[model samples]
Target: MNTFERSGKHLAIQSWQKLNSKLFSGFTTREGGNSTMAFHSMNMGFHVNDDPDKVRKNRKLFSEDIGFPVENWIGSKQVHAENIVKVSKEDRGSGSLDFDTAIPDTDGLYTSDENILLTSLYADCVPLYFYAPNDNLIGLAHAGWKGTVAKIGPAMINIWQEKESVDVKSILAAIGPSIGHCCYEVDDRVINEVKVALDGDTVDTVYKKNAAGNYQLNLKKLNEILLLRAGVLPENIIVSDQCTSCQNDVFFSHRKDKGKTGRMMSYIGRKGD
Candidate 1:
């Protein structure tokens, strides 16, 4: 996968087929938009306490570049849960509908219909994109600590299977950029939780003890395992080795920003009508 910039505010590692298509999807960066110091520029998350006007403008830039109306994006409130919601064209503008009764607790969203954009917000959390290239069904998920521990990848795959009747093995997965283990220091509590959730196999491969004995967990690697375990082919998985905390210039790192920062978005959708 090779990286490309869209609307100058978003960055993406393009898949082989996506390089020349109207089906636009990618991860956003904190650049090329109107925002203050903490939020910096190009911040797309309104929930991060960035100015509402700036967030709107940034989102508008993204929407225009992608050739979709800004209001058509289906976003989650992102409570770090593993709830996978199956959305359709009819459900368009429902979750983020009216801005008040928006979705409150979901980390994964799936849709087989075209025209409705599926998005997952992230600062450092791993963004997983799913596409059944044959059926053309697509989905996206925000897999943080809680979402990973809850096995959100498998949950999303199961929902897609049931809802769209697509085979799990037919899914192609792309794990977007996130906090690498070199910088994602975790305490014993997170280690224990991840170990238990992964049944010990994920411990040695994804976690390492530093000189100070604190653990560093690689959420990207762990999520790759999750994708494989969920029946996605190993060759079908594309991982962005770029680290958010490592490259603060192109990404928003929650740890690096001390929780006072904006977010980037990983989005995927079929070509609109």
Candidate 2:
């Protein structure tokens, strides 16, 4: 992954092809902006205790750095559900001022319109960006433990194929930074849920029981397998090795911060043709 400091935030790229003169995608950190302690610096999420004005300013800097209008970007309320909304130009600036009507309890957003930017909130959860070059469609989803267990990753692919005529095999996927196995200690319940969610081919490799009897799960690998099962080419998917808990200085980790932490934004949009 390549990192760059922008708007006092750290941005990472899973693949160079994900970047473009028009398409913009990045993961935000706790630097930059004007929020005070805890949510200090560039905190883009408004639901947190961070002041709304400060979040707005931080968002302004974030939007400008990515060359998009601050008021034009749309963010989901992120209910951790499997619902994926299809965005349009009419949805611009929906959640920037109000989360009620804007977000509306969705975990994923997709769009073929260039004017619409699809964004999802993430603190420690994995941010999955989907790009179908053949169909000129883009999607972004937030996958926490529950959502992952529900296999929302594959569901998103199914939606694209059914709604947008997307060719799953030609799509490219990128998994952003999140809590890794080294820090994501799980109990028997989560391990069982994961094993049940993943297929037989991936069950053995996705989780490992340590000497202490605790299970360490690799969410990145799990999602990679999900994408492959959803028909995406193995070589077309790239996962970031950056662990949020391991590298707290550059990214936000809910585990490290004990639930109070800033968020990283993962976005994908089609270029205007």
For residues 170-203, what per-residue lDDT tens digits would candidate 2 score against the true structure?
8878888888988888899888788787743447
lDDT of each: 0.79, 0.77
Off by over 4 Å in 1: 1-7, 16-20, 94-101
Per-model TM values vs. the true structure: 0.92, 0.92
What is the overall TM-score of model 1 with all chains considered together? 0.92
Give stretches of model 2 more than 4 Å off: 1-8, 12-20, 200-202, 271-273
Model 1 over residues 1-273: C-alpha lDDT tens digits? 434344455665466336437566689888788898899898878787778888878888888777777667888788888988777887666433233444668788887788888877888998988888777778888899888988998887877777778887778788888999999988998888888777776457788999888988899888888778778789888888889999999898999999999989888876655
On a 0 to 100 scale, what is the lDDT of residue 62 in model 1?
Answer: 80
Clash list (residue pairs), candidate 2: none
